[model samples]
Target: MEDKFIYTDKERKLSYQILDELKDTLDKSFLENDLPMLQVQLKDSVAKNTIHRNVFGLNPILCSLQTAAIAVKDIGLKRDSVIAILLHQSVQDGYITLEDIDNRFGKSVAKIIHGLIRIQTLYQKNPIIESENFRNLLLSFAEDMRVILIMIADRVNLMRQIRDAEDKEAQHKVAEEASYLYAPLAHKLGLYQLKRELEDLSLKYLEHDAYYLIKDKLNATKASRDAYINQFIAPVRERLTAGGLRFHIKGRTKSIHSIWQKMKKQKCGFEGIYDLFAIRIILDAPLEKEKIQCWQAYSIVTDMYQPNPKRLRDWLSVPKSNGYECLHITVLGPEKKWVEVQIRTERMDEIAEHGLAAHWRYKGIKEEGGLDDWLASIRAALEAGDNLEVMDQFKSDLYEKEIYVFTPKGDLLKFPKGATILDFAYHIHSKVGNQCVGGKINAKNVSLRTELHSGDTVEILTSATQKPKAEWLKIVKSSRAKAKIRLALKETQIKDGLYAKELLERRFKNKKIEIEESTMGHLLRKLGFKEVSEFYKQVADEKLDPNYIIEEYQKVYNHDHNLNQPKETESAENFEFENPTNEFLKKNDDVLVIDKNLKGLDFSLAKCCHPIYGDPVFGFVTVNGGIKIHRTDCPNAPEMRKRFGYRIVKARWSGKGSSQYAITLRVIGNDDIGIVSNITNVISKDEKIVMRSINIDSHDGLFSGNLVVLLDDNSKLNMLIKKLRTVKGVKQVTRI
Candidate 1:
C-alpha cells in the first residue's frame, strides 16, 4: 500500500523561504547539493509517514528550517551544525541513519546528530530535567559543544513560535525549561543576547503580569529616556570626535526580565530603578589596538562625567572565561542619575553577542580550552556519584560569575564568586584541600570558610592531623571542593562499611554459625535494612550493634529452618513472637491509629527514626506480634519496605497523644567561647522541652555535637531547632 503524505501550506511556505534565505547566505555548494538532497530526503520521510509533527502540531520540516536559520544567523554555527539540525529528526525517525549521514555529509555532522538523538531518547524516557537525566543531557552537550549550541538555537526557535500556542501547560513547561536550562546554557556560552531573549520570553509566559508591567513601563518612558540619552551622549560624541577616535554610540534598555529581577532584588518598582538603560560605545579599532581604544574611550567618558570608582569593571584586561570582553562603568549623567556605560571594540561586541561561537571563529579553532575545562569539571562532579550534587554543581557552574585570586608565588587563579579558602585549596590540588586546616589571606590568618576576594594573596595552611570532614561540604562554595569532599566522605564510609562487614562475619564464624545468605538477607530486611551495605554502614556508624545483629540473625535462621515443623504442636506464645500471626495489612486501608485511649495491641514508637506526633509516619509490625511506629522518612523505612513489605502498614496520629517523644538534633557550629553554653541556654529557655543529654566533640576550630531532647510533638522540636539556629556561632542545626 502507498503511504499517505501530509504537508501543510504553511510548512511549504516556510521551507521555500528558508531555502531562499540559505541560497543567499550559505555557500553555493551547500545550496545546490546538500540543500536539495536534504529536501528530497525530508519529502520522502514525510511521504512514508516516518516523520511526524510534534505534540504541538509543529511541522518537523518547518521546525528544522527555523532552528537551522537560528543556528546560522544567531549562533553563527557553520554548515555542519546546520546540516545536523536539519537531518537529526530524519535520522531519529529511521528515515536516515548515522552511517548514511556520515557517508553523505561528514563525521562531524553525524556526531552532532548522534548527540541530538541521545537527548531525544533521554526525553522520551523522562521528559523532566531531573538529576540523572540532566547529567546525561550535559554529557551529550559535552561530547560536542556544537550540539549544545544547536540545542539552544532549537529551544529559542521553539520558544519564539510557541508565543501564542494553545497548549498553555506545555508552553509553561517549555518556558520553565528554557529559563532553568537553556538560558543559563546560553549565558555560559556567552550568548548574552539570546540569554536575555530567553529570559524575557520565559517571563512573558511564566509571569505574564510582571512581564507586561515592566514592558509597558519601559515603553511609556522610551521617548524621555531616549532624549536624555542623546543629551548625555552628544557631548561625549563631540569630545571623542575632537579626540579623533572612531566609535558609534547607542542607548540600550535593559530587558523586561532584567528589570523585573532588579525590582525584586532592590525591592522597588520600575520608577524606583535607576540605570534602567545602558549606553554602549562600540569602537572601530584594529585587533592590536582594541584594548587601547577601549581604555581611551573609558578615559573620555570618565572625563565627561563624575564616575563611580567602585562601579568600574575592566574585563578588557582579563576577559571573562566565556570570551566576553567589555569595560563597564557607572557615571553620573545629565539628571544626576547614575548611568551604566559599556565600552568595547567591534570584535569584542560580536563575542559578547554570539558567545563561544564567535570566540572560536576569531581564535581560529573549533572549540575553546575554557569550555573544555568546564566540561572536565562536570565530568568530575558526575564521578562523585551523588546525582543531586551533580545537578547542583552543573547549574552553579553554568551560571558562575568568576573572581580571580592570587597564589603565594604570584600565580593567578580564578574561582567562582563566593568561593571559600577551602575551595581555593581544592583548586590547587585535592591533597591540599583535604589537609587544609586554615589559610592565610593577605597575611592574616583565616578559617576555611573565609570567602576569597579578588587580587588577595592566599597561603594555605595544612597539617598531618587535618582531614576532610562532613562539615566541609557546607563550608566550601566551589563544585570542585564539594565533589572532592563527597568523594572523600564516600571513601571513608566504604572503608568503615567493609570493616564492619568483616567484623560481623568473623563474629558469626566465632559463634560456630554458618551464615545462609538468604536468611541473613531476610533478617536485614525484617530489621528495616534495604541493602546489606547500608546495614553494615549503620553498624559502622555505631547505630546498630554487631552483637544485636548476630542475635537477630540466629533467631531468623532458626525460624526459617523450623518453618516445615507441625505448627499446631508449637507453643502459641513462641509462635506469635516468632512469626507475628496477624494477617497482612491491606495496602490502602490498613492504618495504625495511635491515640491515648488505644487498646488490644501492644505498640511503641521506634527509636530508629523518632516519629513524634504531628509527623507523617508508618507502622512496621515487629517480629514479636507488635507494631512499631516509624516516621515514613526514617532511614530504616526503605529496608523494611523492600525486604518485609508485608509488615508495612500506614499510620497516623489520631489525636493529640500525651506522650513525650525523644528526638535527636545534630548541631554544627564554630568552636567559639561558650558556644556550647549558648546552645544550652536556648534549650533551657524553652520551658516545655527537656534536654536529656548533650554530647559534644570539638576539632580544628569547629564543633559538632548531638543533643537528645524530649518533646511532645514535632512543633516543639521545630521551635527548639529554630531557636538553636539563631544562637551565635551556630551554622547548621538539623534533626537526626
Candidate 2:
C-alpha cells in the first residue's frame, strides 16, 4: 500500500528461498556466458541486483528488472556489468552511494553509475542539456558505451512501467516523457518495438478521447477484423510456403495517436485513412538473401494485389544512419482496402525491438561502448552557465532537432534545429562565425541567418575585416552564433567604452589638465557619482556625456546662468525682426573649436542670404559638436535645422565682411478635400532656393510643402518667408 513499495505476489517471492531461486537464474546465465575471470564475481552482481530491488516499490518496475536481467545476461555481459544495469537507478532513488558502488562493484562500474547520475541530473530539470553538453556526452561514450546502454535500459524500463501507473498526473508525465524523449531515442537506437509501444502507450494517456475512439471503433469490428486478416493473409502464406521460402507474416495497425495525426494533418476521418494496417514479413534467410527474397515476395504480393508503386520503400539497400533497415510496400487488399507491408530479416526484427541495445547484444553482448564522449560537449555547455544566449544555445542546439548538413569538403556537420548559415559558420570555426558577413546557400548568395535544411551544401562566405552586426541576432538561430554574437557585442561595447574614455582624457590632456585621482574625485563627487573612476568608466563604456562633463568644468570657472531660450520677434506694421539671443554669441575669427558659445563656435547670419534674426540656425563646431551655421528658416533645415533649433543662436552682422548661412522656407495650404494641389501653385510660381527632403502626410483638407534657401542675414531672412502665409488657400508659413 505504501508508495515506496510495490506489494505484489512477486514482491513476496523475495524470501531467501526465492532469492536462491533468482540466484539460480543468475548462476545459470553465468555458466552459459560471462568471462572465466568474471564467474568469480557472480555473487557481487546478484547482491547489487537484490539491493536495487528495494529502491522502487513499483511491481512493474521489479518485473522490468527481471526482464532486463534476461536481456543483459542474454547479451553475455559480465557479472559486474550486469550489476551496474540492475543498480542503475540506485543513485536516482537515493538507495546507495557512488562510493559504495566504487567500493563494492569496482571503479569501472562506479564511473558508469557516475555518468548515469549526470544523465539523471540532466533529466531532473526541464532543460535538455545544450548541444555542447550533448556533443561532449556523446564523445565521452566513445570510450565506453555501457554507460550509454545502461542509461538507455533504465529509460526503456521506465517507459515499460508507464501504463501501470495509478496516478493520472504521474502517468501523463511518464507517457509524455516517453513520447518526447524516450521514443525518439529508441528510434535513434533502431529499437522499433520500444518506440512503437512507447508512442502507443503515450498516446493513450496524452490523447484519451482519440485513444478510446480508435479502440472502440476497432473493437466494434473484431469479427470483421479477423475475417479481413484471414482473407488477406491466406494467399500470401500459401504462396510463400509453396515457393519454399520460410517467412512469418502478421498484420499490424498503427496506434491511435498515429491515426489521429493523419486525421489532423489530412483533415479527414478515420475511415478515410488508407493503409492503416501494416503486414509484417519476417525472413529467416541470411542478411543478403533476406533482401533479394523479400523483393521476390514483394513481386508475388504485387501480383496478387494492386500494388501502389509510390508506396514502396527500400531501406535495406541503404540503411538509416541509426541502423534501421526494411522493405516496405503498400497494396490494395480485399474490400478495396489499402494495406502496407514491411519486410525484414529476423535479426532486423530483433534490432527493431531492441534498437542499439539489441544490436549491441547481437554484437556478442559482453561489453558496451560508453556514451560519456557524446555527453562531453553537453558538460562543456553546462560549465558555460545560464547566460541567456548560452542557455538558449544549449536548449536549442543540444535538445531541439538534429540536422546533418555537409561542408564543401564532404564532412557532415550536425546542427541544431533551425540552424542558419551563420550557425554553420560558427560551428566550423569561431573565426568563420565572426568574419562571416554573409554566405551562399546551395551556391546562391543568402543572408547569414538563413536556416539550413538537411543535406544542404552550405558554402560560407568570409572576410577578415567583416564583423558581426547587432542585427545579426534577429536571424541567426544556432546557440553557438547567439552566444558568439553576444560575446562579440560585449567586446564591441568594451571597445566603444575605451574609445570614449580615451577621447575624453586626450582632450583634457591637450588643455594642460592632468586627469589625476583627486581632481576626478572632486568632479565626480560634486556630480553625485559614487566613484571617480566610474566617470572615466562611463566615458569608456560610451555612456557618459563628454560635452556635459567638459561644460561642467567650464561652468565652474565661468559661472554663467543664461540658458538659450528661443523667442520669435516681429511687428505687423514695421515687420522688423529682433534678435533675443545671448549677447556673448561667439566670433568666428578662429575655426570652430570647443568655445564659450553654446553652439560650440562663433556663428553669425551672412548678408548674402540675409538670414533674419528670428530664423532657426544650426552650429556645427569644428571640434566635438562643432559649429557650421544653418538657418532654421530653411525648408531643408526643418527636421535637423529645426531639430537642433534650440542649439540655434541669434547673431548680428557685427562682422566686418559679408557672410551667408543656409536656411529654408515653407508654403502651407489646404489639399482640396475632393482632390487638388492647393499648395503646389505657390511653390511652382516662386521657386526660391535649394530643396532637401519632402515628406507628405495627407488627410482631409490639409496640404503643406516646404522650400529651402540660402540666407545672408537672420533679420531679413525671417521677414521674407513670413509673407508667404498670406497666399490664397495657404493657411500659414513660418521660417521653420
Candidate 3:
C-alpha cells in the first residue's frame, strides 16, 4: 500500500453537494473570501460525528455547526467567527484534540474552541456551580470576544432544534437555562433580534399554555392589525416623501414572549395590551443630518396621528448605555388602538439588530471595546471571590436595571436601583465610604441611607472618626460596599486582638509566669473562641473576667503536674495577693477587705451609687480594676450578691477622708440660648469642681442633655443641683 489518506466509510455518506449551496449563500454574505478553507474544516469536523448522537438523537455537532455558521454569516460576522463556530464542538467532544485543532486551523480558531472546551469542562467537573456562574465563566474567557460570539450562536442553534428533543426534563432544563442565562447574555451584548428569538423559543417550552395562547392571539389578529398598520403609515410616508427625506417604513408586531411579559407585568389580559405593534422608520441620511431628519420625521408622524406624550421614548436624544438609538412614540391609530412609531437612521438600525457584533462589523476590527471593558469589570469581581455576595453582584450587573446619577461636579455615575448613598460613596472610592458620615443631595442635607434616583446631585460628607459598622452591611445594596465593610471590620478585629494579647501578657507578667502559644491555644479551646480578635474583644469589653482567666490558668498549668483534668476542689487560698495591695487593711480597721488577703488595693466609689462617708456600703473586686464601693442598699446590690458572693467584701462607710467622685447628671428644661453657658458658669464658681463632657439635644422648645462632672461629696452634689435648678430655663436635674 502506498502512503495515502483513507476516508472512513461513514465519512463518505456526508453530502458535499449541500456545502456547495452553503458556499453560494456565504458568497451573498461578506464571508465569500474565506469560504474555501472554512468549508474544508467543517467537512472534517462533521465527519467525526458519524457515531455520535445528541440528546435529541441526531448529529448535534453537525447540526450545531451548520446552524451556527448560518447564524454568524447572517449577522455579518467575519470568517474567523464562522470557522470557530464550525469547530466549537470538535475538541470538546473528542472528535479532534486541542493540539490537532491548533495544527490544522491556526491559533485563533484553536483559542476560541479551547475557550468553549474549558467552559464545558468546568461545568462538567463542578455541576454544583450555578447557571449564573457558568454564564460569568464564559464571559471571563471572552478576552478574544470571538468565543462569546460563537457561544451565542451555539445557543441560538440549540434553541432552534430544541423542539426535536424527546426528553421533557432535558428539554425543560435547556429552556430554563436559555431563558435565564443565554437570553440575558444576548440582551447585554445588544443582540436584540437573537435575544427575542431565544426568549420566545424558551418560553414556548417552559410556559406552553401561555406561549400557545399568545401565538394564537397573534395569528387571529394578524389580518386586522396589518390593515390598521397600513392605514397608519400611509399618510406619514407621503408626508416624509414630500419633505425631501429618504426613508424605509415597515411595521412590526411584538414577539409572543414580549407580549406575554407585558400582560403578566401589567396584570392585564391580551385585550388590554396596547402598543403591541410598532411602525419603524429607518432614514437614509448622512451622519451630520441624522438628528435633524429624525426629529422632522417625528413631527410628521405625530401630525398624522395623535401621540401620547407619556409614551414617548427619545433614545436618539441620549442613546441607551448599550448604544441603542431611536425615537419611539405611541400614537392613536385606527379604531383608537395605540401603535408605536420608531425613528432611527440606517447605522442605528444595524447597531440595534447586531449590538456588540455591529461595532465589529462597521469598524472592521477584531474586538469590541465597550464589551471588553464590561467583561473586564465582571472578571475583576469574580476573581475577587466565589461566594454568594460576588455571584449576586455579577448577576445584578448583568440583569439589573441601571439609573444614572450626577455628582456635585456634574459627572454622571450609573448604579442599580435601590442602591443607597453609601453604595454610591463606596463606588467612588473606598476611603470616601470609610469616612462618610452623611451628606447633602442637591444642597439639601440627607442621611447616608437615602436611596439614589436618576439626575440627583450627590455630595458625600465625611468624618475622620466615622468607621465602618457591622450593621452597615445590611444597609448597603452594592457588593463593593459590602466587601469593603467586611475588610474594614476584619482589620478592626485584628487590631483588637493585638490589644487583647498585650493585656493578657501584662497580667501574666504581674504573676511572674511565662506565656506560651500552647497555653493560649488551650485557653481559647476551653472557652470555645474561634478567632483571637473575638476573644480579645470580650476581655476588653468587660464581658469576660480576668480573675476567672487567671484562676483557670493556675488550675490548668501551675498546679501539680496533671494537665488533663481541672482541679475541681481548689480552695480560695490558692489565689494570693501582694503586700502593696493588702497593707492598707491594717492601717484602717474600718475599711472592708474583699477575698480576705485582697487588702489595701486601689478602690473607688461606684458612680451608680456615689455613697456618702456615713452610708452603709460593700466592695466589689472587679477583674483587673481593684475595687468599687457600692451602697449596701444599692439597686444592683441584690444581683451582685446573688451572682458572685466571693467577689463581694463586707464594708461600712467611714467619715474620714475628702474625695471627689465623677457623676453623670441628666438635665431637662425649656430651650434657651444661654442655658448651657449659665449651667457651666454655676459649676465654675466651685473651686473643687472639674467639668467633663456635655451633650445636648433640643427639640420643640424643650431641651434635654447629659453632663459629666466631679463633685467632692454628696453634700456638694446636692448643693450644685440646687444651684442648677435655679438657672434660667432649667427645669429638672438628677444624678444618673
Candidate 4:
C-alpha cells in the first residue's frame, strides 16, 4: 500500500494524544512497538480508499480511536479488544486479511477482528435490526463475549457523536436501535453507567420533548433535591463512620429515560414521582469482609430510617447472574419521602459499573459459566423459529428482573420475575413440566399458573395421565417452558396424525378400496386441509370421523375414476330427524336464502359450530344432496374449504325469523357461592332467551360449565354472554 493519504498537523497531534491516553491504560510494549506499525498500515489502507466515514459522517480513524477509548475507559477492555476495534475496518474492506492480522497481532486479536467483520457484513446486508440478523448478531457475540462489550462501546461512541449529524432520519434510526438493542445489552452486561448514558442519549434523540421535560425538571429541582439528599445522608454517614465502616456515599439522580418510564407507568408528572434519586454507599473492603460489611451498613440504614420491608433487595447474599452484588433498600428519609439506598463493596461496584469485563477480571476468563448459560438460552430461544417469540425472549431475557426461589431439597433456583410454576417445572425437566398437574408452595397447593416469589419452596406435583395442552402456553412465562410445551404438543400431534393416517388406511383396506394419493390429496384439499398431517390430526382428535372421511374419499375416488356406480345403501340411523320439513322454514321463506336465491332446498344448521341468525354463515353440501349451514369460523370450516371447495355455497340470513337457535356458552370461574344461580339469573332475566340445560363441573377451587341456551339471534347470545361475564367470580365466558 502506498502512503498517499496525508494527515493535517492538527489531526496528527490529536491522534498522538489518543494514542498516549490508550498507552496509559494498555501495555507499554504494545504501544511502543505494535501500535505505530498498525497505525501506519491503517493510514496506508485509508489512502488506498479502503476506509470511509460511517453513516453519521464520522471519520473512521478518529471514530475507531474514540470507540477503543470507550472500551478501555468505560468497559475495562484490554489490548486485544482495542486492537480488533481499530483494525476491523481494514479487514472488512479487504485491505488487510485475517491471516495477516493473525501473524502480526496474535490469534486472539485476529479472531475478534474476524467477529467484528462478520457483524459489519451482516449490517451491510441489512442495516435494520431484523430477527434473522439479530440472531446472527447474538451468535457472533456468543462466540466471544468481548465482541459484545466492544460493540456496546462502539454503539455508545456512535450515539455520542451522532447528535450533531445532518441526517435526522439516520439519527432517529440509530437512536431507536440504541434503545431497542444496545441499551438492553448494556443492562444485561451490568454496565449501569454506560447503560444509563445510552438510554438518556437515546431518549434525547427519540422522544425529544419528553426527555427535555424530565431533564429540565431535574435541573430546576437540583438545589432542593441536593439539600434533601444531604440532610438525609448526614445522619446515616455519621452513624456508619462511628460504626467503623470505611465507606463513601454519593447521591445519584435517576436517568431521564427512567423518570420518563416512571411517569408513563404511574401516569403521573415529574413532581408526583418520589425516590427520584438513589444513595450509593460504596465500601472499601476486602473480598472476605464484603458481605458482612454490606449487611452491617444495610442494618445501620434501616435502623436509622424506617425501611419499607417490601422494597428491600438483598443481592449481596446471592449476587445477580451478571455479577452484580449489592444490598438495596427504600426507606423514609428527611421529609418522610422514600429514598433508595445501595450498599456494595468497591469490587462489586466496579463489576456493576463495567459489567462482564470487570467480572472476568475478578473470576478469570475460564470461569465465565454464566455467560455460557445465557448463550445457551439464546440458542434455545432461536430454535423456536418464530421471529416475534424469539425477539420477545431476547428482550425479556435482557431486561426482566430475576426472582430467586427454592426447591424441596433446599436447592436455590432463579427465574424471571413473572415465572410461573410451570416455568419451574419445565426448568426442572421437560417431562416434569409436561406432567406437572400443580405444585405445593410452602406446603400449600397452588395452580401451575401461579407466579413464584422469592423464598418460596416449591414441590411440583405430577400425574401420569397429565399431558401438555395448548392452553399451557399462556400459563408459563419462561421461553424454555413455552418452547418445550410447543415441541411436546407438536410431537403429540405428529404421533396422533400418524395413527390417524394408519386408521384411515385400514378403513380403506377393509372396504376393499385401493387408496390413490392424488385422489386422497384432492379429497383433503376439498376438506379444507392444506397439509395431510393436519387432516390426519383432525381425524385423530375426532373432530372429523374416520368413517366420514372414508365416505368422502369413496365419493371423490369414484368421481375421479369416472365410475357410474349406483349410490351406496343409505344408513337411516345417520339422520337426526327423518322429516326434512321444518315449521319455521314453511312459515317464512325470506328468513333464509341459499346461493343465488335457491329456494325449497333441504337444509339444516350444522351440529358442529351451530349457525344462528346474524352469524356469519356458509353452506356445505353434505354426503347427501342437502346443504348444511355452518358458521364461517367453524372448527371444520378450514378442512371443508381445503377438501370440498366446490361443495361450499355462500349463504346469508335475510330476515328476522321467529325461530330460536340453540347455542352453547362455556363459563369458567372460581367455585364460589351462588355462582350457578348468578349465571342462571342472567339468562332467566333475558325475556326472549331460554335456558335448555346447564352442565357444571367443579374441581380444585375452580368451576367450569357449559350453558346451552335458545335464542332468536346472535345479538341476544352475545348480550347473554356479556351479562354472564359480569357475574361474581366469573373469570371467563366464551361461546362453544
Candidate whose lDDT is highest: 4
- Best candidate according to TM-score: 3
Clashing residue pairs in candidate 3 (N, C-alpha, C atoms within 3 angstroms): 581-600, 582-600
lDDT of 1 by residue, 543-610 (tens): 89878988888789879889445655766654212113423221111224643334335677788887
CA lDDT, every prediction? 0.79, 0.59, 0.72, 0.80
Which digits, one per residue and each the tens of the lDDT, describe model 2 over residues 1-736? 3233324564546433433444565675343433342323433444444333322335433553554554464222344456565565655566567787777666766765666566554343343333334433332322344555444455556656555566777777767667766566555545566567667777788888887888787788667777888899998989878877888987787776688888889999777877577889888887558778878887788889998889878877765555567888888898889888888888877766655544433432121223322233333443354111121233223223556565665455676668888888888887888899778866789977688865466898899899777788877777777898889877866776577768988787777665555455566777888854456657775576776787666544333323445557867864332233534333322222122332323444333333443443444333354344544444445565445646544432233222334555555567655222433343444434333444445567687665665544555455455545655665767555
**Cα-based lDDT at residue 679, candidate 3:** 90
What TM-score does structure 3 among the candidates reach?
A: 0.53
Error of 1 at 371 (Å): 4.8
TM-score of each: 0.52, 0.47, 0.53, 0.52
Q: Lowest summed lDDT over 10 consecutive residues: which window, candidate 4?
A: 384-393
Q: Write the per-residue lDDT of candidate 3 for residues 308-345, one digit (tens) a residue.
A: 99989998877665667899898888888878889999
Clashing pairs in 1: 529-639, 530-639
How good is model 2 by TM-score? 0.47
lDDT of 4 by residue, 178-200 (tens): 88778877887678899999999
Residue 102, candidate 3: alpha-carbon lDDT: 68
Over 4 Å off, model 3: 1-18, 21-51, 125-134, 361-736
lDDT of 2 at 43: 32
- Candidate 1 runs further than 4 Å off: 1-5, 28-32, 125-142, 364-736
